[model samples]
Target: MFTKKILIDLDGVLNEYGKDKFNENYIPEIKIGAYEFIEKLSKQAELYLFTSRNLMLATKWLINNNLDKFFKDVTNTKLSSYLYIDDRCICFKGDYCNLFDEIEEFKPWYRK
Candidate 1:
């Protein structure tokens, strides 16, 4: 049993996602450093693959990339986790003042 649970996003976080149009049935190749990153992170916490895509497809992608061993499971729902690692998230600093602007200006790292 792991002490911490981390939710990791699949698309932009693990794979080269922004270059191609969205396709539910397809997952792009793993991103550079992704395998090593996951391998390292898995040692620290219970990692779960979090995605809106089909779980079966995501699992297949993980298997093809030989990354399935690092993850506990693939889930679409936001489970209870210590942290969420995603390319499209904006950290909330307990202030709503700048949130709207941040949302308006926000772009994933790949797009920027």
Candidate 2:
């Protein structure tokens, strides 16, 4: 079996960005169940975290939450990756007409 490489985003996917009003702290507010979900996925395939945030900030957030171990690498805007996971993306498996169906069936945290 060929395991696919997955790249995940930080600001919205794993961490909630701008959650607190006008708060400029470097700290990241982690999404619910994000750490465990990433850890499980890491065991199945290659995992990469791609974020536009400052490297030091992103690194510190991951390290503080103990989620750093799950990622094979952490990238800022300077890197390239495959199969990016970001909230801003509209992803689907097949034809456009089937997009809604695919999304309805898609569950990143669980597989059958």
Query: Which residue pairs clash in candidate 1?
Result: none
Per-residue lDDT tens digits of candidate 1, residues 10-98?
Answer: 99999999999988789999999999999999999999999999999999999999999999999999999999999999999998999
What lDDT score is found at residue 98 in candidate 1? 97
Residues 1-112, candidate 2: write the lDDT tens digits.
Answer: 8877888888767875556553445655788899889989899878877877677777888888899898877886534445778765566556699777767776443122
Stretches off by above 4 angstroms in model 1 are none
Number of the top lDDT candidate: 1
User: What lDDT does the true structure give each of the candidates?
Assistant: 0.95, 0.74
Lowest-sum lDDT 10-residue window in model 1:
1-10
Candidate 1 Cα RMSD after full superposition onto the native fold (Å): 1.1
Q: lDDT, candidate 1, residue 68?
A: 94
| lDDT, residue 99, model 2 | 78
Number of clashing pairs, model 2? 0
TM-score of every candidate: 0.96, 0.68
